[model samples]
Target: METFSSIECFVRSAEVGSFAEAARRLSLTPAAVGKSVAKLEARLGVRLFQRSTRSLTLTEAGQLFLREVGSSFNTIQNAVANLASAGGQPAGTLKVSMGTAFGRLFVVPLLGEFLRRYPAINPDWHFDNRQVDLIGQGFDAAIGGGFELPQGVVARKLTVAHRVLVASEGYLQNHAAITEPQDLAHHQGILIRSPQTGRVRSWQLTNRNREHSPLMLKARMTMSDSEADCAAAAQGLGIGLVSMPIAIPFLESGGLQRVLPDWYVDDGNISIYYAEHKLLPGKTRAFVDFIIEQFAEQGLAQRFSAV
Candidate 1:
């Protein structure tokens, strides 16, 4: 489509910062690339670039548009080219972001199978607890818990990231009996700090009866990472309110037991994040589908839930 071609030209020009360089990459003459960009600007009625005799820079609107559409253009190109080729095997680098432990437990194990299926694709994985800027940082995709979605970014949820109270048997045995939500105040609390805001958050625990009970918890040991909170709880530091996925193994192995098993905090859903567009590259699509299917096959939704 001619519109698609115009978008490609504009995005490439913004990326390389020069019409000539973008033209070289797209295998077009500088004049042609410049014309395509001009056509695009005329059609949109916005100047995408601030041009001078020596250099070219994107206008404010151009910068915003590129942030929203640049990565998507890459996806479209890959999809179209792959469709024209033999088998639509996604090739090239897949830059993805994920939570450290979640990726290790649910995603890292499956890397072998994914790479085996698409040998041409190179995986670039960034494992961190904090959220990364998908468009600004040039990331192709991301997997983790709820993050504030930027313009043109969409999410596919993997599972509910339910939070439950957990502690070691030794700690529970030494401390007073925690029969209800209000009783947690008497125990030492191993709490989690917000990764984004760096503030220790307070929450209301919920039960199947739909009661939102307030917890006036004081943290004796505070941590930012979810796994660290679980680890502290396992070490008998105190009761920790943590996501079930990180604590599932410890719970099954008897290293940790549910504290007040009747209640939990509904944090939100863990989701796969990517740019929204009409067409996505086979690599991005493959990874998204593969991760979702793998999670369903493993029954991770129930495993990650407190119910």
Candidate 2:
């Protein structure tokens, strides 16, 4: 019988088209992944992959085998995970992905309490600005805004991903007062370039009275991260469009002040995303529920909202 490790190595290598890339995702050395696949191929008595110096292509038989076992492995893992958590506390590596600044500011603060409550689970968190393949990349969960819901993944919303304009007191004092959205045209902008798109994002602000206005500002500087935008605005570089979660601390510290306070850009909701499995792992469920409960307790949803 082919071992689970060997099967996993073969499937991952097939999906990624290379042993080296599969090894990185599986947290194994390239040689180990290659050896595992070789073992599986030997047992099956067939060439699973047409391995070459530069590439690894799946053979016709390998493609058929992958189609049969690829999804089966995930199902088997989920079943095993469910069983493990059913008889005991949530135990294992809980892998998650989230936006760097938001995770540090909000989610990271909850780690101590979460760990105290569930010590058996070890967290493996990846923090970056872009969305991740929750299932394909083998993440237990992800937290962020504006993710396209892939098949078998669901999002539990946490808070409104609202962006509000902000500027330093010094900068505000020196520049023309911004009492309305149209006034932004006169000020310089510390803009955010979308990490996914690599294009400077444009905002359409909505006021309390269901009024909409386009954001027009002279581009003084551009950054790919919202945290950097806040920092630049705090330094009196220019007015910035900042997410409420990232701006909350700076606003409280008086480093940044809301410009046109009534107007905000609704990007969407920040959510905890997980696989839509019937037998969901306890760690994923626990983390998702805990985050929702904490956000509610802290009134984060209201605090992060502009309207």
Per the 3 Å backbone cut-off, how many clashing residue pairs does candidate 2 have? 0
Per-residue CA lDDT of model 2 for 237-278, tens digit only, reads 999998899999999999999998889998999999999877
Top-scoring candidate (lDDT):
2
Write down the worst ten-residue block by lDDT for model 1: 81-90
Give all candidates' CA lDDT scores: 0.86, 0.89
Query: What are the root-mean-square deviations of the candidates from the true structure over C-alphas?
Result: 5.5, 2.2
Model 1 residue 104 lDDT score: 91
**Per-candidate TM vs. native?**
0.80, 0.91
Estimate, for each residue in 1-307, the C-alpha lDDT of model 1 and write its tens digit: 8889999989878877889988886789999999999999999899999999799999999998899887767767766745742365677778899999888988899999998988888899999889997865667799988688889799999888788899999999998999988898788888888888998888889997878899766789889987888888898989998888899888999989999898999888999999786687677888899999988998888788787
Candidate 2 global CA lDDT score: 0.89
